[model samples]
Target: MTDPGAYPNPGQHPSPHGQPPRNKRRVWPWLVIGVPVLLFGACGVAVVASVAGGNDTTVTTGPGDGDAADGGAADRGPDFPGKLDDDTAAPAGATITRDELAYTVSPLEAVDTVLGSYLCSTVTIDNVGTSQNDFNGYTDWSLQDTGGAIRDATFGPDRPMLNSGQIAPGGRATGSVCFDDRTGAAPGTYVVLFEDTFSLSTDRLAWITTL
Candidate 1:
């Protein structure tokens, strides 16, 4: 005969209030614990790997091994030709003397249509001296327009006296000569002459004409 406390027969249903059989109970306890533990372990490994990699990195400093030298080398370069050195003392050259001052009407001259005036020709003075000298003198300047009429020329202050009254030996003074075109002078060659105030040299002359 079967014992009364024994499990129910395979064909019989369980009592309404009784618990289910042991093997039939849900077996998710290990899954619940192991899944979280595995995830935590993976996260810990990732953090540790990140920290270890960061510590292994190195930062290099200072100039690159192939870099060129500093700019100090260029600062010690060659000196100017006429400049004086600290230990060397030399006197300046002789005083500049003016021989002849002459100018020609440059081909680059232009006329202002709005102002109805001709731009004065560019006058170039040649230094016919053998040694360095200074220039100090004044001369009246004149300009000829397109017509045969002659007119006086005026200078702007910006083009102050050449060399401030001092011309280096063999150096020439050059400035613009501005004049009005109202003289009805035809576009042609113009003569420029100067009377030196210093030595009363009346023969100093130069010429230039319009193209």
Candidate 2:
């Protein structure tokens, strides 16, 4: 028989079916000690893993630190022709010559859409001669279809206006043509024309088409 209030006999373990004597020391002390130790060990492992993962490593390269050597030596000279002197003479038969006029259809090309569409054309006149040339009184600019049907064109504010205006040598003037009305014309080859009063000549500038 065992006394209820008495501790179990020394060197004799009591059966678990009987109520064990209470440990006066609070069990919360072990919980507090174990939780902090486990948390600290987990934090230490996390820090070690972060450092070992090399998440902070960074490499930097300076101007000349690569396999390719710096080819930009100070002694290297320009590969193209430099500025020409004012006294330079023009080549033979180059008197007041006009360059091949260039025209562009914007948005550079045509747009393909099931609905309505619009596009602009620009003609660039470059004065490559040594002397200034007057561009005044140049008016008739139009777009024509392949079948010889002429499309009426209007000049916007950016169009080349001669009104006694002169473009200096090496200067350029841009004339714009916009097409909004599409009645009989479908997507096909078209020719843009620029007629000037200076020489009574007409220039078939560009051949473009729509999608």
Candidate 3:
């Protein structure tokens, strides 16, 4: 028989000085793979943290911001409620004046229409500006009830509608502005808000009266 102790067993190697046989597998290959896996895990965690931080960012706006004074409706912020909030409430028949423009609104009157019923109010717009200004009754006026509900002007009534045209300096125009008569004949608190889009002023006029 061949010399049995001359070579070690399969998958093992002899050690010096008759020490235990060593396994053939080397640890370097496992170390190379494990190192790359650890690095990729750390990079994934960092990417997730960065995305989470970006989602936490926020933006805010205030009254004194230049958006209101600078540009048209497109420049306004999403929270802009079509009118400014600082306008004080004036009683009916009171002349509330804005930049070079004066306004007077009368009490509400009920009118029946074939399409529907409506509440009408007479408004007088006096242009005291140095230059001529245009007033559009359809887009310039709105009414708010005590419940914070806003109503736009409706042309379904029989009364003479507000004149929409250019007014020269030191001139005035008068006519009726009507709204859907949601509240019955009993008078309810109403607020009339007027914003002259033709003028550069962002300020609006508000009149509080019974409808």
Candidate 4:
């Protein structure tokens, strides 16, 4: 107020009517910006941590992984490794054993002899029948490829045929079934079939599964 061109003294500026100005540090700027910035950074970190810790992985079943069924020709509701009796035709009195056998199929990831492109799986068969019948891994089982091509079952030299002259009733057999997709095991649905004998009827066991 004394001199309009003079600058104010340090920390004490001239106020209106010649009053002294109050001394105060500049902090409101930092409080306004810094507090929100810190909160935003914390929330961002929390979101990243939640995403990293969440279990988002899925275990996919490859061509021949997991349970194998004995589905009929088409995917007629759970035709995998289960009973294959023809409900339509049973031997009059004995209830015609139909296909009283059950099978489990597990995919074989890598095999020494199996071609790199070929798909392989292990089959476990449980014969619940009362009679002793033969089991042939190769001639008994079959695979349907993505293109609807039927591939015959075969094994490497080490893979033994799941057989004995007598897979007695209640007997179990294990064998390996390999398939050549011709185009490799592409992504799609494949069907596995099993029959004690290669008969042309849908009475055999069939399973529909994805690759």
Best by TM-score: 3
RMSD of each: 31.5, 26.8, 15.9, 21.2
Per-candidate TM equals: 0.37, 0.37, 0.55, 0.47
* lDDT values for all models: 0.40, 0.41, 0.64, 0.53
- When summed lDDT is taken over every stretch of 10 residues in candidate 4, the lowest stretch is 87-96
lDDT of 3 by residue, 73-192 (tens): 232222222345434345566665555556678877778877877777898888877889778777888887656678787784567789589889999998998888776545557777
lDDT of 4: 0.53
The worst-scoring run of ten residues by lDDT in candidate 2 lies at 86-95
Candidate 4 wrong stretches, greater than 4 Å: 1-75, 78-98, 107-116, 157-164, 198-201
lDDT of 1 by residue, 1-211 (tens): 7565675566554557786644566669989999999999999998776544411111111225221221112321122232222111111111111242222223324556544655454444545545553433234555434444545665433333332254454567665555655654454544433334444223323333334
Per-residue C-alpha lDDT of model 2 across residues 1-211, encoded as one tens digit per residue: 8675565556555557876555478799899899999999999998777545421111112224321111122211112122112111111111112232212233212323454443345445556567776653234455555454665454334333323366787787655555433544455555444344444222222333443
Question: What is the overall TM-score of model 4 with all chains considered together?
Answer: 0.47
Number of backbone-clashing residue pairs for each candidate, in the order shown: 14, 1, 0, 14
lDDT measured at residue 206 in model 1 versus the true structure, 0 to 100: 32
TM-score of 1: 0.37
- Give RMSD (Å) of candidate 4 vs. truth: 21.2
